[model samples]
Target: MPADVPGSRSERTEGAARPGGVASAPEGGPSQAVDSVLDALDPDRDRPANVIETHGLGLSFGSKPVLSSIDMQFGRGTITALIGPTGSGKSTFLRSLNRMNDKVVGFRHEGDATLDGRSIWDPGTDLLDLRRRVGMLFQRPNPFPMSIRDNVVAGVRAHRIAKGKQLDVVAEQRLRKVGLWDAVKDRLHDTPFRLSGGQQQLLCLARALAVGPDVLLLDEPTSSLDPISTEYIEAMLAELVPALTLIVVTHNLGQARRVSHRTMFFYDGQLVEQGPTEDLFERPTNLQTERYVMGRFG
Candidate 1:
């Protein structure tokens, strides 16, 4: 399940987890240069395509299995929501998308997960590149103990993507994308801890966006915020989908229906159903899905 988002629980299942680390460039200098990462964020890049796909995927930690025979697809510049009861492996599935489970002890998997048809599990895969293409935000906003400007440019600098004025431009553009630049523009040099929880979460979002990911993964991003903050995030997400793919794990079914173009329901480590958001909510093919969506059971 999730680590910091209180009340946003996850079932232990058989396996799960991942934390980020800097990865050396592949045979080449870097998978993407500073300018390329920045260019990815341009609003014009928004378009529909199958950006992520999983086939016959299965995962286990030690001997316990958390996911099995799962097949799913995520479209570029679209939003898809994963919903299920506690311990059903929602977070586990999300983590696997970016190999986040690599940090978990005894974690292993079978089957294929691809980004643009390239296997993510390949030994030659560039971890940093994968992360840049697929950025993630946790349930709560965990800002680095640094100034807002530094927080936004952390990834960019780590990868040596940009410098000087260009770096400043990246910071400003991402902050604006998340609607935090205007609020924090004057205080860009101030520490992030000084911001309210809502602002901090948005800051975290800006940090993720600074790298310009092709697919964005959020694990209950709004679960810890106040209603007003939640509204802000949801609105921002709507605006973002036109440029990057978004896969969100949320417990709030209402929120799922409100924000997703496609809805997926999981149970006991398996995907029970998935379809267009309206069709799934209005007419689920599976009884469990219907019951869950109807508030009959989680």
Candidate 2:
């Protein structure tokens, strides 16, 4: 297997000490996950970009701040990693990107998050459009109870993508992009629960991709997978990054250094610091960052 998985770690890293000396990362880079399939994105050489930006972004639950004054920008077509110990609100921050936080009755926040400069908080903003543009994947692979094919195409169906053959074509394309197509093609008529945990997660990813989102958000996406499956998803993310803005919140420090273009350190609901992955990892500006990354505590 080729070892160019976009975020391949240095051999000296402890994770590389895999049994039988298997490649610590996935095979042939993450690009292989979706190489043959083409996204429906229009080709405009000078088209404007779609970046996720926020300023003074803060969230509070009943007067208790969960995320306070976070100012960060995630570049379009790049992956940003949010890392910190437990209770740092990493997941909360990710959900806030799409106003998923608003679903909770007591959720309150101050500041604005803009997707491609459009304020997501503005009452005039079309929430359906915003959510469609910024899709999300959960930690566990929770595919619907229906067939694998049906699970992948749910979002497409929600938006009413064409019909019949058109939907099938799009579903196949997205499933193949996430490496689940061949595995489930023959089983498209079978129930999703019949597939392994890993495949279910990939199917969830296919569902997110089916809508042609500009940004993808993951919250501890591989926490339950075995190492092989974990590596597979990591590789898949690398392939997906070039066409989508990716923001990942994980407690795994190694995952951050491997796949992130920018790394942000959060502590106790506050952003301690953020910068280029290498810069932040090598020399953290805040004491909290240094302590957390060095394993003083989770």
- Against the true structure, whose TM-score is highest? 2
Give the 10-residue window scoring lowest on summed lDDT in candidate 2. Answer: 12-21
Clashing pairs in 2: 2-28, 5-29, 85-298
User: Model 1 — which ten-residue stretch has the worst lDDT?
Assistant: 12-21
lDDT of 1 at 171: 92
Model 2 clash count equals 3
Give lDDT per model, in order.
Answer: 0.82, 0.79
List model 2 lDDT by residue over 177-233, tens digit each.
Answer: 988888888988899997888888899999999998989999989887887887788
> TM-score for each prediction?
0.83, 0.86
